[model samples]
Target: MSTDPAEAAILSTLAARGPSKSISYAEAAKALAGNPPDDSWHKSMHPIRLAAQRLARAGQIEILRKGKPIDPDNLHGVLRLRLKEQPE
Candidate 1:
């Protein structure tokens, strides 16, 4: 488990974005964008995907397919994430 700041930032941003009607890899890339060129969207994608998967497994979030969350959902398809609130 690498705790790279950039990866952590990406995960935190996604969690903060809340549950959307739909979310794409491009959207995630955009959310993690920094300065132009320096903030290359493509470079951040792989890490973002990995982070999302890890978060999903930990039950911190649910990845939805066709507007619903389920394992049968296609991994290659677009996803909408639902974030779980921290217990008080």
Candidate 2:
């Protein structure tokens, strides 16, 4: 699997944030530091969103919409993500 530095960094930050749930793109960008892939925060945000989507699909994280948990909220809309618990 090809690892994306930006995606990795964002995931790490999410792991660190933990529990409370839901993160905004602006907040994520600031936490990652240095602009994302495309240099423009606007353009760069797409990968971060994609990473979150992928993680959610793999059951590694939960995606939220307006604070309530949901699956695949509209991509063009605002997104919020939280880590998922591993099966015990």
Candidate 3:
């Protein structure tokens, strides 16, 4: 339970997806912004991406791009957030 809408949304949705699945930052962004699953959701990506980096640093999640784990600090293009196998 975090005050950050992006953090909350990312953590909650990955939990909802269960341990084996992953969620895109875009998906978490939409859920956080209360935006419908449409083009408008794209607007939430930047914040959600930032939140993902923080979450990853906290060991709460893993940041990924193109099906591979990525350095949140080096995030460039598209990315995703998934619950870490052993989150802190």
Candidate 4:
């Protein structure tokens, strides 16, 4: 869990969707911006991506491209976020 709103929203949204599902940057931005998100949600894209990077680095989540995990620093194009699968 994170105190930062972006990070927390990312986690909570993903958790709600379950581990096998992934969310687009826009979805996380919407989650942060609130339901029926306003145009201001558009402003949250970069910050949400950055927060995903931080969570990815900490092994709390994964940044995916082409449905495969990619290094957060190298993110590009359309991306999705999902919680890192816990080892059982």
Backbone clashes, each candidate? 0, 0, 0, 0
Assess every candidate by TM-score.
Answer: 0.62, 0.69, 0.84, 0.96
Cα-based lDDT for every prediction: 0.61, 0.65, 0.84, 0.93
Residue 55 error, candidate 4, Å: 0.3
* Number of the top TM-score candidate: 4
Worst 10 residues of 2 by lDDT: 35-44
Better of 2 and 4 by lDDT: 4
Candidate 4 or 2, higher TM-score: 4
Which run of 10 residues does model 4 get worst, by summed lDDT? 11-20
Model 4 residue runs over 4 Å out of place are none
> Model 1, stretches more than 4 Å misplaced?
1-7, 18-22, 35-39, 72-74, 85-88
The count of backbone overlaps in candidate 1 is 0
Task: Give candidate 1's root-mean-square deviation (CA, Å).
Answer: 3.9
Which model is ahead, 2 or 3, in terms of TM-score? 3
Taking the tens digit of each residue's C-alpha lDDT, what string does model 1 give over 14-87? 65665443456556666666544345778878776777677677766667777677552246666655565566
List candidate 3 segments past 4 Å from native. Answer: 35-39
lDDT of 3: 0.84
Candidates ranked, most accurate by lDDT first = 4, 3, 2, 1
